[model samples]
Target: MIVFFHHLTLATTTTNPSYLTPSTARCNSTAVTSCTTTTSIIARCQSYEVSWNNHCYYLDGLGGNCTTGYSLATNAVLGCIATQFASKTYRSTISNNCCVWTADTYECYGFNNNCNTAGPFSAGPVWSGAGCLSVQQRYSAQLTFCGSN
Candidate 1:
C-alpha cells in the first residue's frame, strides 16, 4: 500500500478568533501545535476537563475519521479539513480546553493523496493547499452535526 503524508498548520483570520485548542497545547506531555481560523457549527465548544482535571479546548478529530485518540491514530479519515491535523487519522486523543465551536464534522485542513498547494481558498470556512494552484475544496458543518460523510 502507498501511504501518503502531509503536514498542516492553522491560523485565525476572524476578528473574534477563538481556539479549538491552545497554541501551546500538549498531549501526554507532548506539545500540541494549534492553528487558528478553525471552527464549526455542530456544537459550541467552551471549556472542559479533557482527562482527570486536565483542562482544555483542544482540537478533536480524526487524525487517522474525524475522531482523535491517544496516539498518532490509525485508519484515519483523509483529505478532510480540520485544525492542526492535516493527514488521515483516527482514534487519536488530545487533552485540553477547545475553542468556541470545535466541531469534528466541519472542514478544517487535511491531505488529499498527491496533495499540493491549491490556490487561496474562498473567504469563509477553512481550506488547505500543498501552495500553488487554484480552487478551494469545502466541507459541511453538517458533518460536525453528524459525522464524517
Candidate 2:
C-alpha cells in the first residue's frame, strides 16, 4: 500500500496606503489528500491563490463541468473556499470574467482590462496563429475578491 499527504500554507501581510491606517497580516494552513492504487487513483488539486489587500482566495478544483461555461464552476469553487477559510471571503465584489476557450478557433481569450472590472458577459477576443491551432489545448482564468484600495 502507498500513502500520500499534501499541505498548503498561505501567508500574507498588508501595507497601509496612508498614515491613518495600520498594516495588518495573517496566515492560514490547510491539508489536501491524494491516494493511488494499481487500478485507480484519486486526487485533489488547488488553484493558485490570489491575494489583494489582506484577503486571500482560491478555487479548490475545476468544481464543475467547463463544457457549459466557467460561471458555474467559478461560483461553486469560490463558495467552497469561502466556507473552508472562514476568516477570509471570496471576492464577490470583483467582476466575473473568465478566460474562455473556443474549440473551433483554438484560442484562449482574456479580458481587455483588469480581470475584476471586466463585464460579466463579454465574449473576449479570438486569435489565430501557430500556437493557437490546437483544439486539444486547455486554459483557465481565476477570479478572486478582496478589499479595495
Per-residue CA lDDT of candidate 1, range 88-116, in tens? 22123331111112232222332333122
lDDT per model, in order?
0.25, 0.27
CA lDDT, candidate 2, residue 21? 28
Report the Cα lDDT for residue 13, model 1: 81
Which sections of candidate 2 miss by over 4 Å?
Answer: 1-64, 67-99, 116-149
TM-score of each: 0.19, 0.19
lDDT, candidate 1, equals 0.25
TM-score of model 2 vs. true structure: 0.19
35-130 in candidate 2: lDDT tens per residue?
112233322322333332233333221212222212221221222232233222222333233332321222222234333342232322222212
